[model samples]
Target: MNYLCLAGPTASGKTAASLAIAQALAERGRPVEIVSVDSALVYRGMDIGTAKPGAAERAAVPHHLIDIIEPSEAYSAARFVGDAERLIAEIGARGALPLLVGGTMLYFKALFEGLDAMPAADRAVRAALEAQCERDGLHALYRELQRVDPVTAKRLQPGDQQRIQRALEVYRVSGQPISSFHTEKPARELPPLISLEPADRAWLHQRIEARFHQMLEDGLVDEVRRLEARGDLDADMPSMRCVGYRQTWEALVEDDLSELPERGIAATRQLAKRQITWLRGMPQRQVIACDAPDALARAVECALRLVA
Candidate 1:
């Protein structure tokens, strides 16, 4: 296994299990470096809300692709694939294992399944589309996408602004249906995937709630305030749209910290649910019940066995 992946829903113990796996590999004289698959972790100064690996943990084990961008910037699946490929090669050249870890399933999908040679994003075209959306509503643009590229439209919701706009932009820019470009993508080798999930839903929910409250106790609100004070980021940015950050930003916008706990916890649970759904769609993943007493040990064994 040239590449090993450890993925799970939020608060499902993925971080602890990944650290243990890396340590176990190191003890066996096989160094492993983690490459974050998370979109949120790529941004700097968004730590507490992201449950990012602490300074000590990162110092203990080399981590890649974290804090690589500013909150005002955008990180896409294509960019992630490019960065991960480079890091995986470099890490392997150093004779260490590259462990892909995080809850960003779309990155994993793009890396393992291969991204189609779609047209690069055209900012000018996209801006025009955004203006049109503002004037005519998202439904009007979605309807236009349906007319231009129904195959892509069928897979998207009427309100999926990013994808809807992209599909339209592709057609308008390249005179081709975006879906037509996906007809013949070269397949990629599927990496060994280990997924940590809980057997008890309520147990996972409790963990999510507890962790959100702990993030608050750890000054996540202060973190958000600092980011907001920077004046360059907003709620619509990908960084602020993160589960915890989004809820905290809304609370701050409303000047109401009291409702943050409920809103943040609820949003985190919803994120976990979406992650689990994505994990289930990947048939190659090996599942481990994360709430088990021996989960970490089992995860280490599984990882070591795969990387051996």
Candidate 2:
């Protein structure tokens, strides 16, 4: 199968670049479809925060793996691998090249190297630990994690609530460290994948800030309002905990846009830094350094070379 994956840090102009490549392939009479590699974009009514493609852009080329689930359901990288592989195969069956695009590194990892079984959520233990978190504070629970799953705890930021809760839940159910379950063997597969990185960090940061401001101008607040109105802000909803969505929710509750947008921008910048680190680690894929205007051309050149 001829599959092309476009991955980079959040706010790295990856969306536009990937779309451009897909359009270029289409222009060359190659049947192509975009399958989102994003975790957040899978949830419905999460358009602005996830930066999901608008109706016009999607109509221009078929997009898949988006808006496939409600916010209340949690999805894992293993599930994403299953769904994405199925979609890619169906697209390939129809003689179309599948262009995989997004920033979820775990999804890419799972797709490439497969995941071992992890403990499922133990609601009883989760409820007890979550209650403990509410009463004793998240730090107390995180400290508890540090005692048992020290390695995983070290990897997580102290303030990371989701992962902390998950680790605690794992200990409760499996009677073992969550870190033990994370197993990957050194295996290799040749995928028709092309990745792009911007040469200048300063330039990419500016683009990140500009794109976030544009999202606000495009009614991100209203989008959040609509999702909130639909009860998507409820704690059980997975989309509520997305990075951007969480910040916006804080803004909504505080009614403070004065500093929230800048906070959002800063968070996005940090995320982009992590993405750059991820890209640097993936040594096998074809890499192209990009500027805005020439990014598409460079990526297309790489893709054609790979598929040749």
The candidate scoring highest on TM-score is 2
Candidate 2 C-alpha lDDT tens digits along 241-291? 676777777788888878867888888887787667776767677776765
What is the Cα-based TM-score of model 2? 0.88
TM-score, one value per model: 0.87, 0.88
| Lowest lDDT 10-residue stretch of candidate 2 | 231-240
lDDT of each: 0.91, 0.81
Which digits, one per residue and each the tens of the lDDT, describe model 1 over residues 1-308?
67799999999998889899999999999999999999999999989999999999999899999999999999989999999999999999999999999999889989988787888777678778878988999999988888989899999978667679889989999999999998665756788999999999999999999999999999999999999999998776778889999999989999999999999998898889879989999988999999999999889989888887
Error of 2 at 150 (Å): 2.7
Each model's backbone clash number: 0, 0
